[model samples]
Target: MIGYVTIGTNDIEKSKAFWCDLLEELGASVVMDAGRIAFIGNGSEKAMLAVCTPYDENAPHPGNGAMVAIDPGSKEMVEKLYARALELGATSDGEPGQRIPDMFYGAYFKDPDGNKACFYQFA
Candidate 1:
């Protein structure tokens, strides 16, 4: 029922580089690269994380109360990716840990474009 998620960015090149390096861990690469927009995928139908310039020609900003949640391969993968995100300049929103006993484990971060995302696993 889900398709893709788009994150706006004022600096398309910077956002692209950020994603390219980050997604390299998941074996994803640029599948669509237009001038102002780009997308990456690792052979998934849902691999549609886009970084784009605002169509209205205004500055890009993160939408309030909006976020994208990512489900990685495992808890260890989540931990690794979350740390890697910080190393690549993303800010930590939450540390990786069990969230709600017997329910889930997760970590959150704000991307270079200020788009917030989560990496989660279930126990």
Candidate 2:
């Protein structure tokens, strides 16, 4: 398992806004914002998201097939985060709903740079 993920974005400000909004919707707070990088989570003592500027415009966007799944605590929380992602300009991959019936409920969305991310609650 990975400890953290740092994604490179062409527009730092836009990326920051999108992620900050999404995290807030998931009940997490922005813990750090040092111009080029922004970290969001419960607090500075436990940052979970790290957003960084792309080294080059030609850098490839993260693929849709590679998704970062967030555990939003509950099905309702996942739904809320999914809605917030869409509200902030993310394109929908799927609507929030139950999946694998007995196992999960979630939704998927794509970030501006085409990175795929999802929020899910597992049973």
RMSD of every prediction: 1.3, 2.2
lDDT of 1 by residue, 7-117 (tens): 999898899888888778888777788989888766447557888998898998898899988787899999999999999999999999999898899999999889999
Residue 32 error, candidate 2, Å: 2.4
TM-score of model 2 (CA atoms): 0.83
Q: List the residue pairs that clash in candidate 2.
A: none
Looking at candidate 1, what is the lDDT of residue 32? Answer: 85
Cα lDDT over the full model 1: 0.87
Q: Model 2: per-residue lDDT, tens digit, 55-89?
A: 56466578546778889799888888888888889
TM-score for all models, in order of appearance:
0.93, 0.83
